[model samples]
Target: MAQLGFEVRDLEIFASRTVADGTAAEIVHREHQTSVEVRDRDGLSFFVNTAEPLESDPAADGRLSVNMLWLTPDVPAAITDLSNIGARLLKTADNGHIADFAAKNSGKIMAHFAKTAAHGPLGFGYHGKVEELLERLLAAGIDAHLIDESYGRTLHITNPDFADQPSNPTGPTIWVNEEDQPDQYGYTAPSGTAPQAARLDRDSN
Candidate 1:
């Protein structure tokens, strides 16, 4: 998301894997997945697998999830990037602060974008079983919430070692969700529902 202001990481290390001949950012093609590691301004590194299936598993082939939702300084530019990729507009906030878009053929929202830089850069959802993952996190003494939704189970866990961010008072959170019946990231919101983008410190866990 270099276009959206996230910085690419470890470019030198992936020099041999660089495949984009003239692209601004170095697009690295790993053996099984074509991905580039990137970090937000907050130094949170996110592993971005582009287009291809993250793993060689057949079940996950051609599917990608909307794992991270970020707040951008520029919303229109972000919209251009998504629009260039032909992402479908799923929802948008009335006051134009938030928008959710999903890639073609994918069940989950590809990315959630917010206009203001006041808060967040929040992320949510996991590719696997949330209940099992939550249990493990709880065992490790992490602060987490396990919420059962009509579609599946979800967990909201507080980010560790990052409690001092003023913009993110409650620190950032990592959301995990169980796979829905369709086997893709099947969480869907009914059209016209207000976008309840998570806040920094408002923990209902």
Candidate 2:
């Protein structure tokens, strides 16, 4: 495995209006002066800066829950490392895309590890690898979190609030999910699928 260095700085919250609705609200938490370095892999590194945040106010008529702007100052070392390991980094627009891609891939890796772990010896090996990879991701500045559930198998890389929407055009809004799974939502399976969840305009509902 290889190590990636991230210099994180200047974290601040900003306000913006939704494109769809003309309401105003705080949006992204900007991170400034961030840089990532990779060693012993492909000698590639990445530099990032958190740009201005985009809001999700309904009054602004915007569909975007949260919008983060990031740039790759240099080619990512992960790309080379993955290539050496017979994997490749998918093309994406920014770091957020890379983070999402990594999180999803990590989920699949964990699932396989879980299956092997059930066997005993191989399970330990799987767990070790999984832990190592997760640690690497975290050290590389990925925001990974476990979603509580019966299986406890969900891993997310971004904050949930980034997906929230205002309830009404001018009302306070919150993030909601319509996923047909049990985790944060206090619901049971076999009863019904997950209901359509949305950030209701605080005053509308």
Candidate 3:
């Protein structure tokens, strides 16, 4: 764990899927989730380098560089399902359940937040144009709902109770350095700010 640059025992994970206009939410979540800026303009993706999933992407295989994040072999979806279950439990205030799930699945982990994508094109907050994001989410097969103007964007595909919950006027309690995206469409985020970030930071890399 020391060699990995963190105390493994203290690690916690958070996984998110882009539902509505996640660009802004992605920015905030990046504060707690180690994130990398990635942009999808047309069919081309712009990043620090070529992008591909670690499972089959040779570029992400064992390559250790500031630009390239190394990863483990792909864990079966059954294992990732545990992460999904744990994440939902954590969201619902079930820490004990997450602990139990982690105790079982954290050992053979590779990377990812869980199933990400909008449950549908429901807008949350963040002043950016919601239509564009709505189109993206719809494209991904999520459903559509009302425009969320309350500045509470991030849609946790799990917590149904969180739907009507009021947004916290005070932003996040924890603070972090702000990193810039490389260019107009680039994505930027922390490296290992949180365990969840560590998990989502890679995907085919």
lDDT of 1 by residue, 23-118 (tens): 122345778755554333332333444333334567642322444354566555544443333344555544455556643333333343443432
Question: How many clashing pairs in candidate 3?
Answer: 15
For residues 75-137, what per-residue lDDT tens digits would candidate 2 score against the true structure?
A: 243333322222222222232213111211121001111211111110101212233434655
Clashing pairs in 1: none
Candidate that would win on TM-score: 1
How displaced is residue 175 in candidate 1, in Å?
2.2
lDDT tens digits, residue span 1-205, model 3? 1011111111122213321213111222233344323322111111111123335456531211111111212223322333332221111111111111112212212122223311111211222434544565568775543333232223222223334643422122111111111221222112343222123222212
Stretches of model 3 off by over 4 angstroms after superposition: 1-131, 139-142, 154-205
Give per-candidate clash totals. 0, 18, 15
lDDT of 2 at 167: 27
- Model 2 alpha-carbon drift over 4 Å, by segment: 1-40, 57-205
- The alpha-carbon deviation from the true structure for residue 128 of candidate 2, after best TM-score superposition, in angstroms, is 33
**lDDT of model 2 at residue 13?**
17
